[model samples]
Target: MLESLLWGAVAAAPLVLGAVLAGIRAWPDRLLGIVLGFGAGALIASIAFELWQDGLEQGGPVPLAIGVALGAAVYFTADRLVERWAKRAGGGAAAGVPLALGALLDGIPEQLVLGFGLADGAGVSVALVVAIFVSNLPESIGSSSDLLDGGVKRPAVLGIWSAVAALCALSTVAGWALADVASASIRTGLNGFAAGALLVMMVDSMIPEAQKRAKDLAGVATVFGFALAAGLSALGG
Candidate 1:
């Protein structure tokens, strides 16, 4: 139980930090390009060094390819649907629903994959947790900023973020439980799929937004942010 809670905290750390960072000044738009560049690099590295290799070792090329293709397709379709919905709703509750539901849906699968990795071995789990944490930090910050920009009160923003963190905890715990019953091949495939999905998400969404906000000190801050993430990944490794 203590171990699970500790892992949960590790998972939530990035989101908490991101929320705090979002309260800072907006970054410049140009910096978004740079951040996206680094993010793309990181995603590639994660896929090559961790997800792809691990999946191959555990399942083989066929399963890894299938998982990657499926994951990519799902996210691509979901992204299109969400964009359409957001366009139709145009800032009303309907607009918010897609974003909130997307975020909520994201948490479950991601945490579940991480939990399975962690259950397999400390090294695999730690590497993935670190990667996800690094990725989530920027995402959380962006989410908070979007909410605030959309006129959400600070208290409400904090509450929503906190609730999401709690959901992450639940997802991680549930994943750990599932790890006990699931086959290693299935777990590996799922993790690979998650890696692919995250790559698409970072490329198409997070990095683009971060780049849009990059300018002046924001550019420098974005570089610092990537450095921090890289450092954390190294330390965790």
Candidate 2:
């Protein structure tokens, strides 16, 4: 459990770093878009290679299908509700809340996967960890800045991200606890669930945001990010 917590924190620490960066300096939208593009690509690759593939192998097709469907439905529904609430709040001041919710949606599943991976006693999923770290840094930077732009007090912005980081870190422990007693099918379902959630998140939030901000260059960054993560996975395997 302690190990899981340690690794989880290590993976999520970038959010704090991103918040500090946003607090300290101004980042151009183009740059944030490019970073998000890369992160989206990397996360997509993680879904394919890290989460889904392993899940399919461990639990076979049925659970994978079920988990994926449920994960997508839940995330999509919850995201819409959050967006509606944000809109109801009125003005750009509420924009950051949605972004923060999005991050939580994305982060929790990824972190859960991290704990699950560690639970096997097979060591950390270095590829997944690297991808998570890479993806998170840009996300945090963008979200933190959005919060600032939304007129959230700076300290409050930091506090929000800090709390998120702590929650994600603890989610790993939850995964670890489950791993200790779960059947193979359950483990596989969890992986598939994480994959589905991540895919929906990328399509619904990350990719659109990247395109809105980076324009054409976002494509290039995405390709590079995918290639980089894929290479890392191949090498690790």
Candidate 2 structure quality by residue, lDDT tens digits, 122-212? 6865775676777677778877887788787789889988999999899889888877677768767777776777688777777888899
Compared to the true structure, candidate 2 yields what TM-score? Answer: 0.90
* Local accuracy by lDDT, each model: 0.61, 0.78
- Clash number for model 2? 0
The residue-by-residue lDDT of candidate 1 on 1-237, one tens digit each, is: 445556766877676666666666664445434544444444455556656766788788777777777777777788788778767767632222223333444555566766775676654445556676655655566566676666666677667777877887777777777888877677666756766676667656655565565534444555565565556556555
TM-score of each: 0.73, 0.90
When superposed on Cα atoms, how far off is each prediction in RMSD?
A: 4.2, 2.0
Please tell me which predicted candidate would have the highest TM-score against the true structure: 2
Q: Where is model 2 more than 4 Å wrong at Cα?
A: 96-99, 125-127
